[model samples]
Target: MMPTPGFPPSTLNTEGTPIWITDLAAGDPNHILHVVRGIEPAEALEVLGAKQSLIQACELPDSTPDERTSLPAAALGIEPGTSAALLAGRIGEWTFVYDDSGFTYDDAATKALSADGRMAATSVYTINGDASLTYAVDGEQVQWVNIDDLVLEADLPSMPAELRAAFEAAGTIELEGFESGEADRQIAMRAACSLASLALTLSVLRRVPLLVVPLG
Candidate 1:
């Protein structure tokens, strides 16, 4: 299928490499459609300065889709609700490549790119078998506004000591996923999703500039 129209053409990076996208399934029965997406594998390795051997991808159990039209608004704690946006593309094998959540080869538009000459989004993700959802995106257009000061004011329990120190040092922490019981699971999922979305956005900016719009 063709990419959703109206989104600008993804931009290419300085090296003339066209960024691509791929997605990994989160593997929950009801939320099995949750995916980690962004640029293709090869480019991801190069950008992250890591090799492919580092990535570990996994598969999910086969099952029927859910019948519910509307899941609880507080089911996952995110608003507007979610409905299997991406399907499980690859089957079997669990591999991790730079463990990036941004873009990959299985995405819709990757087919449009020809051979090694062009770039496409490549996804290396797996099913966590949990109801909680997580994702990340990278793009130059997106802005990483610092809400730490505000979040700190909320005084939501102190992050882990090590993690807390890191956040304090950076004055801001990149999106992260932490398995801190049920209470923090939702927050972690949001962090993961934010990172995934931001990374994909950045990848889009680097490769398909025309389609991406950077946040000031």
Candidate 2:
């Protein structure tokens, strides 16, 4: 099991960090996959503030219990210096999606520079859990152009031998049970881990200039 030499971060590419991608499950109506992303801390707060201010400004009605929209920390799913994404990563929560649907993580990338550390622009992401997702920058959400639609996708070379084998194996048919169906479970478990690793690798490599390879 060789390790993927993770994707490049902002420092490597004159452009920026690479992105991870995967297609929606079979027969998924959208025929799309989500590229998990993060956002910088300062920018994340700025975006949130703008949305809060805007939403707070609107009144409910002319006279019927006309309460204003409150941008309370608890209300917006924000904390004194934390967010839903942070909570979900550290401790398994019932939900990871925010009101707008962003998943946050402390070290969501293979490299420290690439992972969101409460400041980097890629710390918080808005996932639609399908193709065509958005991420948070403070409060405003931004969308990633589909990697499939990118001219870049065509240029990406095959992932290194170890990683490519791992990715493909995840799609392999489950082996029949020898007993408690443990064989099939093991296959799925390994596959899930492989995919996670692949995502991190893709996120960094996707930024390489003049680099492209089709995984489809």
Candidate 3:
């Protein structure tokens, strides 16, 4: 997706959606922009007035050929299977997932993370017209955000990892296990979304190292 006037260009991934979000999270220009939850930008602006909006690319490496990981976005040298819609991101000292498509690969997302990673947040879009968001702060589900209503303003309470499995449980879905053929792409898409959601949720909660199921 193209960046707006003030927004910086970052990796935007798409499994099969029109509205694309950048990887980075940006703060308000004056740092007073209220976090927006499940609301349309126009609606938010209408109600909130002309507040500065900031968006940043998530530092997590994107394997997507369009987003650019080790090389430029235009570079054709990206590794196979890395050029997908899922990736990881960082928030303060905490590390979490920021995926576009539902499914993710643990090996790719967590390779740069520490051994004992803390759970942050994950975003998923379901076939049922649901923009589901799961937020695990300090290793627990504090809130569930719908896409339009997602406005994170609360300071994340910091804590140390008691277990080393959090990092191991993130972004490990297999997309190929889902729908096959052009006819099944829609079915596979929903399956991918579900798989992505679970993989992200588990990782942040510090649960058993889960796996993500996705297409190659």
Candidate 4:
């Protein structure tokens, strides 16, 4: 599958669906600009609309690949079997999203995600969607909200073991607590900032242990 710039190599892993979402899926008009550039949650909403509720009805898997395509729309025409393989990984609570579209895999993989109750959304949809696919501050569901710092910190490691440890040891992890007020509104934005910082830090850590890099 074709890859997009500025995405993690894991995005290419057909078995590991991308986890970094954008604001294009279900956010309000004002927040539409935040969606990650590639994943097309908003576009899917345009095509699926209220039908999105169907995602909750499926039997999703635990994990999925995280690719780097431009938008969900990019994967719309991919093969079904590839989609199926990709979706098969997203069966349970351990599902994934991408910075771009899920085009590397086949259509069946995408369908499998829908079939298993897993969800897909761009950063925009996660942040701006009327309903967010991410977890709320108190673990509630907010279609367009961002995940709390605590949630991101807690979840990042679990997203992938080797990757998580690598990041942690590298001291590149940057998940700060939510602001005192307006937690939801700032979650996505904060995550974006923290992630960007983490990326830069990780680059250095990957080479050598900085003071922040743990010995674990």
Candidate 5:
């Protein structure tokens, strides 16, 4: 697929790393990316049930994704792979949170994240080739798509017209056979992320001083 205009180019940072959303999605299969509009990173973390003290004290030094994942466990002196860390950063009015270890697809959590007339969307890609995108607005799920289940439903009455159109244009609302290759699946997942206005890349992740919240 050709790069979309207005989308950030593959090299989105000074480091010149050719990072794109599809690359990240394909490389890291078991991960969740949450994009919350009109909220600070700290507020989003709090909405996800992270304690304020822990959020304040658990900012890991800026490091590679691997280091970030293991540093939290080492710092807390816990068994490796036992602690889950959430990395989040703010861009404009949206705060993006990346969870490489687990998924937060709980209804209550999604609603809470979109409370107070906010908007929240999450894109989850599992290792089993199942991918999902959930969008909530003002505490209600407005759009949802599960690739593996061939489910694509948008609350047209409540969802913004632009978003609905974006989904349609990106083929997110079209249900067909599951993508067979990892690259194809990554492209599909990246489309979902794009609909939620999440143009994340590894360079962006590295440049932004993400707040690391350790979940043990």
Candidate 6:
């Protein structure tokens, strides 16, 4: 579906229905997007073990592809030997952690972030065509899926009904006759993220002043 004119590029349909979790998957590969429920951006960073002292505020503008990829680090004056860089911001009730280097997909970090009545979900898509979606709650992993193959890698016995329904709708549950391609993988990822009410528009992501944290 075409994003509305003048509106930030979103997964929303013309009728304002959110069609996907995020558009990042369709853009660059080798990116990881994490959403944590009911937490401030700093708190999310803390849970990920990023030092607050190294966090810098930066404006990521919606621009050309080259600029989009290089601007964040440039704006932050990222130093040499920086092992990881993460852009963090808050949207609605969720705090989003974005890493182009795909370094934000730690299972243990997800579990830690989801502790204390919070929920954490992450979508990772690598340039090698590896993709996964994971959800955790209260310091435990509740669901994990291999998005590239549309397989349920792991799940609890009492999985959330909403999540099960989402998987079914995305055709990940019944895979005997299911045929999927890259587009289908994106759909599956979107369904998984939608369960957590996570959606980020490119415009919004660029306009927001995000916290840039560099990790060793």
Using TM-score as the measure, which candidate wins? Answer: 6
lDDT of 3 at 145: 37
- 1 or 6, greater by lDDT: 6
Please list the residue runs of candidate 6 whose C-alpha ends up more than 4 Å from where it truly belongs after superposition.
1-28, 62-71, 79-82, 149-159, 165-183, 207-209
- The predictions' CA RMSDs to the true structure, in order, are 17.3, 17.3, 18.6, 16.4, 5.9, 6.1
Backbone steric clashes in candidate 3, count: 32
What TM-score does structure 1 among the candidates reach?
0.21
Q: Top model by lDDT, which number?
A: 6
Q: Per-residue alpha-carbon lDDT of model 6 for 82-198, expressed as tens digits?
A: 655677887677787766566666888878888998988777767686767788898899877775444343432255876665544433221233443222345435554465445
lDDT of 5 by residue, 1-216 (tens): 344432455532222112443333323336666777888888888887677787743444333354334433333444435656666777777787666555455656667888899987777767575666777889998767665544235233454775555444344211245332222343334544555555556545556656767664
Candidate 5, after superposition: displacement of residue 58 in Å?
Answer: 8.0
Give lDDT: candidate 4, residue 22.
30
What are the lDDT scores of the predictions, listed in order? Answer: 0.25, 0.24, 0.26, 0.26, 0.57, 0.60
State model 2's lDDT. 0.24
Task: Please report, as a residue range, the 10-residue window in candidate 4 with the lowest summed lDDT.
Answer: 207-216
lDDT over C-alpha atoms for residue 102 of model 2: 30
- Name the runs in model 4 displaced over 4 angstroms: 1-29, 32-46, 50-113, 116-119, 122-155, 158-216
What is the lDDT for 20 in model 5? 42
lDDT for each residue of candidate 2 in 165-191, tens digit (9 for 90 to 100): 433443322234323212221222222
Better of 5 and 6 by TM-score: 6
Cα displacement (Å) at residue 47, model 2: 21
